[model samples]
Target: MVFSWRKRKPRNGDKKVHNMELEIPRHFICPIALDLMKDPVTLSSGITYDRESIEKWLEDGNFTCPVTNQVLRSFDQIPNHSLRKMIQDWCVENRSHGIERIPTPRIPVSSAEVSEILFSITDSRRRLDRCGCLDSVHKIKKWGLESERNRRCVVANGAAGVIAAAFDAFAGDSFEKNAHAHLLEEMLCVMYWMFPLAQEAQIYLGSQASLRCMVWFLKSKDISVKQNSITVLKELLCCDQQYGEHLAAIDGVNRILFKFIKNPISPSITKASLMVIFHTVSSSNEKTKAEFVEMGLVSLLLESIIESEKSYCERALGVIDKLLETKQGREFATDNALSMPVLVKKILRISELATEYSVSAIWKLSKYEERVLMEALQVGAFQKLLLLIQVGCSDETKEKATELLKLLNPYRPGLECIDSLDFKDIKRSF
Candidate 1:
């Protein structure tokens, strides 16, 4: 209800008593809100307001009461429990009106409570007792669910770093198939809750043991565990390109990443895996990029772009552009059955970023090989490039489109669709 304030006598700071237009009692309403107060708390100035409303007032750097305009001696607000009970009773009496009862407010989690919980997590991690780890982490999950503040509290207390230390210990023997995997999943779930992690958390996650930990988790048959692992790895790789490069260099790590994309667990997981792929290729040496291509990443990339949701599709385009940077990558794309059509299909149909990456991928393909220009034309790359230029795109992408048009426009179609020819095809031809 809107309050129309007329000048009032000296009371609290300009207390605007409710403009009695409604059928509600003035004392039943918060003075500041001019409406029924849920969870009323009396300030030092003898003014009561909805806790949320006053908290916001305080948060806005206002030290004075909205009603009294009197400066607060202290910011403490005492819960007006009597007023709350009266409000609840009134709401029940007026249930026929549209009034719904406000549920009892939860006391927000405190730093001390969070500290005790973190201590339990630390103790549980150190001991490696599955039952203890489960109990502690369950408490954390409960605390986190109570409010965003609790999540911040958990992160502030280095929950992620502690979990990473636990994960690191588990990685040393992840292949043993013990209770560590289940406990690791619990730890990972909690850590994943606080992504864009605190610095202390990132420090532990960026270590070598965490890399090995990630590799083992990717092999997890449990989809939830694997998805969480992929997502966390995606962020970690982004933080340090070296992490991506290092992961790519690890034994069978690239294979696991490639395999994740190949199998297609979920859209989010797929996009994350694509990012991990792009980061690894972009940050690594030429040999590392080539090794990924040789391991059959290019075909899966094409499949991803084709089958993907918007997120996966965009990431797949980025990986493709990164892949074409190396000779091995280019050769694989040129020979892959889906490369030409996938590049052509994405040019105008996807988002601008997708168009940019698609144009760049095609440019790398046709620019280097020149012979691939024939295949691009046959797959209608020439027409897509022409459309892209005429409409809109980034300046660099537009320029590449123009260049490809200049090259492919001169080429006639049906110049032998050799894009599908792999090493076996070439061997047969020879």
Candidate 2:
């Protein structure tokens, strides 16, 4: 059959279209596919070809442009100059309306399925020991498209595996001290995907299995896994109220968490530990609070306020605020000499950070102790409060600061020059 040739249409920005004829011998033509070019374009390397079929030809290596004979080593090496410019123009034109790309739905695979896929890849105790599976795991963890559904699935499966593995190891007496440690490390590497899982699992599994896993992981010498384990437990405790009761019942759980809160090497771990303490305190019954107080968690929290890290200080302050809401907690705060002064200072210091949560805690603490309100005024915390107002405080901070200001007015005589400053002066001073 004879083929008919037609001149190609000119592109929008085309200055000129060459009418050059092809002079190549018929035998030298690419015999694999000789279809006419669908979208012919020129590359930066002075090559002219169809973009669609060039990608496949690239794998054979050293494929020169049929017309220009310009050497091209890889598909990436051939720059689509006109296409790039067109994309730039399109982006600029659509900048006002904004391009809306459709989101892909995430498939939720269960833990059993993931385990099966992983086991199918390798029978080794280490999931990543297989050649191709490690890469796949890395991609799933790092590069998988994100959504609430996918996030939940990843977290659930990961947490289930981690909890199951740790429980099996501990219960079956199959804990290979060294090998198990490596497995834990591998699991932690994919922890971001597993966090949502642990959170959901906490709702159904309660605290026993998850808490056991956390304790074992925390005790491990590996700092990475220990950090991740603390993070996972903190997430679970924060998300599920059901975990609170069982979490406090675990032997040495409070003490272990206390150690991390007091002196964790990782800031993230310390923050997580402090969050766990807050959840533990808030969700615990009177007996659990008593047990926490007996374990010196209150004192540990107090000391954390003076910690060199700002996050520790913030978390410590949060725990103290939660504790103050309860009668036993208020008693715990008052009985401890260092608690009031340290908390007042943190309230004022943390006001600079000025988050709604931080300010709410400060407001709650101020309500508990008239002495703390008086102490705050004595330390010119009112000035900080005034500054917060002037610099545009959040609704919570403004409300709390205003209430604390009103409370401080009752103890105004004790405050230095409290009467001298008017509201206008206070506003101007900041």
Candidate 3:
């Protein structure tokens, strides 16, 4: 008997197309190798087609199902083994062709690429600004960021390059209305972001131009510009020894800072000025230190140390340390009757306030072999030193105390008085 193909139908109220009792022939089954259909194209009731899978089978030259020997026109059909081998060989040949060199189509640079580059540069600048990384500024210098052609004036250019160009452009040109306000703002921003860049760049570019711009900004009506200007000025001077002389000679720089120290309107401005003084005094050469003393900086710094706002006290103390480094400075302090007792008392107060730097400065000042130590001891500075040593807050204070003790003869009549006081007997009497 000949087998006949029969179409299956759903019975009444039956949702399934194939009856439960009758097993569907495996030949009519869709190959599990094919993934679930995304865009299924129907072929017939017993068969459904996936265009890609059918195309693959056709490409393989297999027209029959291996299971049922049925011609494969739809998804239900599977290819015979021999035909599959032929398709595999063809695929291998096509893959080999693909592996061989083929010219890829050239594509033009898209707007997206330009936008990405711009965003990358801007983002990098912002990150560098936030992080205050000096190296990132250098990297930006080496790797120039893409700039918009016509809109170059609108957007600020290279991080450091912008400042360099602006300084060059505005060189010898008095502050003019024609100058790009945005560029000026960007220059200030760059200074604010990485101050060392502008400072170092100033060495290559002369100091006059940068100094002029900074001075102008310092006097600007805008408070932020003034603050940033002071910050830049401080950084510029703080960069290295080469800029020191130029900084000291700059008109209004010292006067303006002294004025701020005398009466500051803003805390930030006051702090910046103190920092400028601290760095200037701390890092100056002997000649510069003498110049500072000649300018009455020593008096102002000492005054600031004693009576300025609490914020400036530490910096003022640092300045004192630097000032005391010179014989001239020691004589000045001594002539002013800044006795060891006075200094030790001040240090003790500072230490009580937890100002370690002040303590350290005092410790350093106490190290001067000839005058400071002798004068300090003459005024009963040892009592305060012993007080600090007893408290034991710092190794330095202890060491200084020990050294100062060794320098004095405990058997000396005056020294014997302190040694004679017995703490236990005094406590018992009390």
lDDT of 1 by residue, 128-175 (tens): 656776787778888888877578767777777776766666555443
Instruction: Give, for candidate 2, the lowest lDDT window spanning 10 residues.
Output: 98-107
Error of 2 at 373 (Å): 3.8
Which pairs, if any, clash in model 1?
12-68, 13-67, 13-68, 13-69
Ranking by lDDT: 1, 2, 3
The parts of candidate 3 lying over 4 Å away from their true place are 1-161, 168-186, 193-208, 219-223, 236-242, 249-252, 307-310, 338-342, 348-380, 387-402, 408-430
Weakest lDDT window of 10 consecutive positions for candidate 1: 421-430
Clashes of each: 4, 3, 1
- Estimate, for each residue in 1-430, the C-alpha lDDT of model 2 and write its tens digit: 1223333444566666445332322322223345323333455555555444564565456467655667755444343445444434543554333322222222334456656554533443233343344444554454235444444544444544543343333322334334344444454455544545543345433545446656777887888888877777677776775576677887788788878865667778878888887788778877766766666777767765665456666567667676666666666766676764465445434534524444565577677767777656665557656766777766767888888778877776746443343333432211
For residues 1-430, could you state the per-residue lDDT of candidate 3 as single tens digits? 1112332443366565442232323332335233323223333233444334554555578666433557646544332333333334443454422312222212222334434444444454444332233333333332333222212222233234444544444433545553433344445554465445543355633367666666667667788888877876676666664565566566666666777777776988888877777676665567656655566666666655654545566666666667777777765665565434345445445434323444454555556545555655555555655655665555655665577666543423443222333222321110
- Pick by lDDT: 1 or 3, better one: 1
Task: Using lDDT, give the best candidate's number.
Answer: 1
Give the runs in model 1 whose Cα sits over 4 Å from its true position: 1-38, 41-78, 94-100, 119-136, 156-182, 378-392, 412-430
* Whole-model lDDT values for every prediction: 0.76, 0.57, 0.51
